[model samples]
Target: MITQLRVDDRLIHGQVALVWTKELNTPGIVVANDNAATNQMVQMTLKMATPTGKKLLIRSIDDAITVFNNPKASDMRLFVLTNSVTDALNIAKAVPNIEGINVANVGRFAENANESTQLSSTIMLTDSELDSLKELATLEVPVFSQVVPSNAQTPITALLKGIK
Candidate 1:
């Protein structure tokens, strides 16, 4: 029952708690990141950041795919968050029914010149990561880069061209 899939390097934070939660009306958040899944401290931090009473499952990508593929999962509105475009693409490939994905925030470390169009002082991208995101668009996932609910989103293709 994934209502929305978001790729944000920040994972769960203020924007997610305040904006996306209400917009999607999701009762649970499934974070698909291998690193975050293994780190107790990161998991604890994200759990704390999530709004009280909402469920949060920090799982590996494989676990997320399994949960997402289950036909019975449609009852709960689930929000899937991934840290990278590659991870997001991987999960989408595994669960083809996911249809669309929203690029919430790429964070500061992964931003690169190719992503300049989506640039905010808070996020950075690497060239390879940008290329990976471009490839993702070819798969027809409709990559959008936006920080919050009010900001205008720039398509990944448009951002790629602006890089050079």
Candidate 2:
């Protein structure tokens, strides 16, 4: 079962390696990103960053669904990580048992400035991103904005209420 579907552009970074995996008690991590799956450098980096003894798999979003829906993996505690909100949404839609989504880091790009709102120094969400998040919330899935397990979680629900 997927403990959480995390959206962090940084993918397998320090926090995810040292913090979330231990906190979630997941033995396996599935990175569902098309670009990362095809990029040798990114794949190598992710493998190196994963904690010792933990298993990490990089696959496209479609392949991730197949893994998650597999009955053989029902005993596995998998933490699904994605590079974008769209990727997380795709996984959530395909996998019925996703517990929730954690929005860790959404970096601001040059073009993103035009339609994005800065929620924090590290978080900038486009209007479309917010809409998708809102849609996820409507499905009764709690969305949290937290950089690491040590940080206090800020529910996207509360932030959206203020933004509206």
Candidate 3:
């Protein structure tokens, strides 16, 4: 079962490695990103950022979804990470056990930042990304933004308010 699907551009970092993982109490951490799965450098950095004793798996988005659907996966608590809302949405649509989605950090490194919509201090989305997020909000699972364990989980619908 997935405790949460976090959308963090940094993938695994201090806030995620130390705070969210411990708070979610998920022993397995899966990074569902095609770029991270094939890039040795990115994979190495993610592995280094992972907390000690926790299991980390880096796989392409499709592969991660397959793992999520495997019967054995339901027996373990997993916290999944994706760099974009679209990827998280894809997982949530395919994996019914996700608890929630945290649209944390995004758009900082996006090439089209000039045309992005600012949802929060930590969240900015381009037009295409914003469309995907809107679709994501319509899913059955809960979707919110909470940068750390202490922050209140702000519903993605609330953030989408007044934005066409």
Candidate 4:
């Protein structure tokens, strides 16, 4: 089962490779991004970032969903990562055992930052991303933003309030 699906543009990094893996006690790390899955260099970097002794799997969104739904997957604790809100939404819709969806970091490096909405220090969402996030908020699973294990979980709904 997925302990959490984190939306981080950097995919795997110090905060994620070290803090989150230990915090969630998830030994299996899955990167569910289309770009990362097909890119050899990206996969290498993500693999290097993975904590030693923990397992890592890089798959496209659809392939990751297939892996998540496999009966054997229920026996393990997995932490999934996606680069965009849309990808996270797609996974959440197809998987039933996700504990939460963390909109940790996104749009920080987006070219259209000027047109995006600033939801938090780490989250800047483009118009299309915001639409996906609104839909994500309506899902049964908990959807929130918590940059690290130390930060409090801020519900996506709260951040969406008052925004046009």
Candidate 5:
């Protein structure tokens, strides 16, 4: 069954391969990113990053959704990864059954202006990404930011509370 959906700029890396794998206990990992899916080097890197013996599938957003929905893909605990808030919103909208998204990391954006509040050293959200996150928060799905299971979850509501 599809379990956790994560929004992390670095999809499938050291922390995800080790920490999240152990935390979620999900053997199946699916990374849905257009750029990563099409890039052979990126795909190879993700495959190598996956924990030993766990299954990893990197596909475009649509195909990744199909993989999760397929009956043949059952029998596995799956964690879905996306690099952008927009992409996470799209996945959540396309597949209503997706549990929820964990906002792990958004990274700095070239377009980020002075208005963008730096949530962490790695995450800096621009207006567009923040707006998408706001919309996701309105959905029935839960939206919260936490780099790892150990860190306290910062709900989207709390972060957006004082912001215009």
Candidate 6:
């Protein structure tokens, strides 16, 4: 069901509605953020960002795991987006079947340079986050960083090495 799991701070935005959705052929967009789940205003903002006719679900990380684990999820091309590496790590720990995580726009709030690898205008990194990403990689989950459809991706490992 989940064709792609991405870590993007912006969640559903222009690049997501216009580019990644079409590139991945995703019919459903799932935003897994605890904060967004409880806030009606933020939820409405996220819903407005999505393209018309596409199914959008904004839920907490736990609910996302449940939905992703369900058999019905297999029928839809799902795109899961989280705002932080910690959230991504949490989901991966809860759902071991998820094989990969794509690192997209991490935004301007990220601190701790050692935890993540800076990729572009919308990307940043910190060491603990990078370590968590490595844990996912050890489980055979490939972590990739790409801004948009046309940008080149750099593996998290390579970025880590460059940081060191």
Q: For every model shown, what is its TM-score relative to the native structure?
A: 0.83, 0.90, 0.98, 0.98, 0.89, 0.86
lDDT of 3 by residue, 89-136 (tens): 889889999888889999878988777899998999998889999999
RMSD of each: 3.1, 1.8, 0.7, 0.7, 2.0, 2.5
True-vs-predicted CA distance for residue 157, candidate 6, Å: 1.1
Ranking by TM-score: 4, 3, 2, 5, 6, 1
Model 1 C-alpha RMSD vs. true structure (Å) is: 3.1
Number of clashing residue pairs, candidate 6: 7
Give candidate 1 misplaced runs (Cα > 4 Å): 110-123, 162-164
Writing each residue's lDDT as its tens digit, candidate 2 over 1-164 gives 88888988788989899989999998899999998889999899999999998999999889889989999877788998987776777777777787778887875653666668877766677777766777766666678888877798898777677775
Q: Residue by residue across 37-154, what tens digits does model 6's lDDT show?
A: 9999999999999988789999999998898888877677788999987788888777655545887777457555445456566667566665676675555667778877698877
lDDT of 4: 0.95
Instruction: Tell how far residue 60 is off in model 6, in angstroms.
Output: 0.4
Clashing pairs in 5: none
Question: 4, model 6: CA deviation in Å?
Answer: 1.0
Ranking 1 against 2 by lDDT, winner: 2
Higher-scoring candidate on TM-score, 2 or 4: 4
Off by over 4 Å in 2: 109-111
For model 4, the run of ten residues with the poorest summed lDDT: 18-27
Stretches of model 4 off by over 4 angstroms after superposition:
none
2 against 4, candidate with superior lDDT: 4
Clashing pairs in 4: none
Ordering by lDDT: 4, 3, 2, 5, 6, 1
What lDDT is reached at residue 30 by model 6? 93
Backbone clashes in model 4: 0
Local distance difference test values of all predictions, in order: 0.75, 0.82, 0.93, 0.95, 0.81, 0.78
